[model samples]
Target: MRNILIIGATRGLGHSLALQYAKKGMVVYATARYSTPQTPSHGIHWIANVDVSHEGAGRRIAAHWEEETKIDLVVISATYFASETFEDLHWDKEVAMYKTVAIGPVFLIQHLVHSGLLKKNSRIVLVGSENGSIGLRHESGGAGNYGGHGSKAALNMVGKLLSIDLKPKEIPVAIVHTGYLRKENKEGFFEHGGVVKPDEAATALREWLESFDMSKTGEFWAVRGPADIKTAEVVLGPLDTLPTPLQLPW
Candidate 1:
């Protein structure tokens, strides 16, 4: 079975992915700040207290994978979006926002690559958002308190560059824009008038992972439905000024 490493697995989409993969008989290394769920025993190894932004976090994760088997799949699901207004926060908090949102994933990828934990055919999936699409403006005009829109936009470009780098090595990288989920109820975004459910999002991610093909490396897909029906080029604008991955001030 494939060995899967899922970050942010304590709750939300990450939690659902961890449980689903474990049920499919894969060895899942689930990581999160808090404790993972303990209801069913499905051969899931919960790795807690993981802070991806820390310097040694990647090394620690790599070592853990070495202890058993290399990770075939890496799912980055952890993210932070504080409701802090630009006026209320200091520079330090701003840096922290980018750190948790962008830098953490970049560092983790670098660590995994350098640690020799990822196999040639290994797949890395970045959970991204439509908010990142520079050209794609939400009907709501992005009045949300969290910085999710900008952060997700930055992640999409990172995936593009990563795909270009990993393709020659036969490894594929992808970013999935898991539509807005109802944070509380974990249901469809439209059903609740643009609120998405974590469980539903997780289910979509699992389906995508199951059908992944190396040829589709560096591609971005909508997590809600028929990928072909929705074109990213139409949604995401040019990436001229997009933030570089891991370059955040944090």
Candidate 2:
């Protein structure tokens, strides 16, 4: 079985992805922030106290991996979101969010590569959002969420740089938007807002990566196409004419 490492697997898309991968009998290693792995048990091997926000997170993660095991896929799914308007911006929250969303993944991947856990065929997926897209932001016309949107954009840039740096090793690095997800069904949340449950979004992302290769490295994509994007038609022309997996603009 192939070895897969998923960071931030305690909840949301990360949790769903870990469970699904474990159920498929892949050698799944997952990380959690708690001193004890608080994630629901589903045969996933846990790496506890791995908070991606800290600079030491990568080193902590590296210590847990066995020398004999080389990871086939590394999914950096750890994310922090803090909604902020100019009037009420929280400094601490924004800093934490930026570190988790953009800076932390760098150190984690740096450690993984330095530890020789990744081989040529290994791929890295940085979970980004369409909210990162400046073009979309202009068309969609929503204000606020500065930290959330800004950090994701930073993540895309970080992923691009990583792809360039790792090109010699042929490790394909992709930045992707999973979807607008609903962790739980809230009132009218599942009605028509294009919000999918975590499981469904995870599956869509998994399928999208089947054909992703080195040629597409450093590219940003919406794993489920442009259907869920608020301004897809305005930016990408006609929605029905677009492909299932859409390449996003940075």
Candidate 3:
């Protein structure tokens, strides 16, 4: 069975991925910012307080596994979003977003690689966004989300650099656009226009992962294709002309 580690598994896409992988009978190690539940699902193991924004988070995760446990996959899906405009930008929120989305993954992966937790053929998937694409900024229509968009763009660069470093070890690094997800609030759950549910995103992401290989390392992809990206037509082209599991521009 594959040994998979999913960072930020307490909720959203990471939670769905953990459940899906555990159902497949894989050894799933999931990290949460809080205490692990006493009753975790079968095949799922929880690592508590592995906040990606913390510098030591990676080392903490690496220490959890035994020497013989070679992690086949590591998916870092932790993210922080704080809406901002030029006049109302919050400094603390921006710092947190940068740490979670861009800086933290680099140090964490470095620690894992140095500690031998990630071995040859192991894949690293960085959950990013289409908003990260500099080319897609044209679709923003002057709407501002400075921290979220900027940090993800930084993440894409980080993933590319890590891919170059890990190439000698035959480790493939991929950055993915998980999709525009729906939001749940006290007002009741609501879809954000063309947003997808977390379960649907997880399924598509899993299918995309199955086909990922070294040849495609350092590339950015949209697992949900053009279906959930409202700006796909405006930015890239018509949806009908695009392929499923679209290869995204950097």
User: Candidates' lDDT values, in order?
Assistant: 0.69, 0.86, 0.89
Model 2 TM-score relative to the real fold: 0.93
- Tens-digit lDDT string for candidate 1 (1-250): 3888898887778888888888888888988675556665477787767887576668777766634556789999888775655567545655665677677787788888887877688899988765565555644453454556566667777778888887877778988766665655445344555556787778877776777768767777766642221223344433343321211110
State model 3's lDDT: 0.89
Model 2 per-residue lDDT tens digits across residues 1-250:
3898999988778888988988888888889887645436777889999999888887887788864878899898988887788799888998888999999999889888887897788999999999888878763566788888889989989999999999999999999999988745445345447888889888997788788889899999998999889888888789999997999989
Q: State in Å the error of residue 60, model 1.
A: 1.4
Provide the lowest-lDDT 10-residue window in model 2: 183-192
Q: How well is each residue in 1-250 modelled by candidate 3, as lDDT tens digits? A: 3899999987789989999999998889999987876666787888998889888998999778743778999999989999999889899999999999999999999999998888799999999998898876674556588999899999999999999999999999999998987787778669767788888899999999988889989999998887766577888898899999999888
Q: Which regions of candidate 3 are displaced past 4 Å?
A: 185-188
Query: Number of clashing residue pairs in every model?
Result: 8, 0, 0
Model 1, stretches more than 4 Å misplaced? 34-41, 66-68, 84-90, 138-140, 143-146, 185-191, 226-250
Q: TM-score of the candidate numbered 1?
A: 0.79
Per-residue lDDT value at 72 in model 3: 95
Residue pairs of candidate 2 with colliding backbone atoms: none
Off-target runs (Cα >4 Å) in candidate 2 are 35-40, 185-192
Task: Please list the Cα RMSD from the true structure of every candidate, rounded to 1 decimal place.
Answer: 6.8, 2.2, 1.7
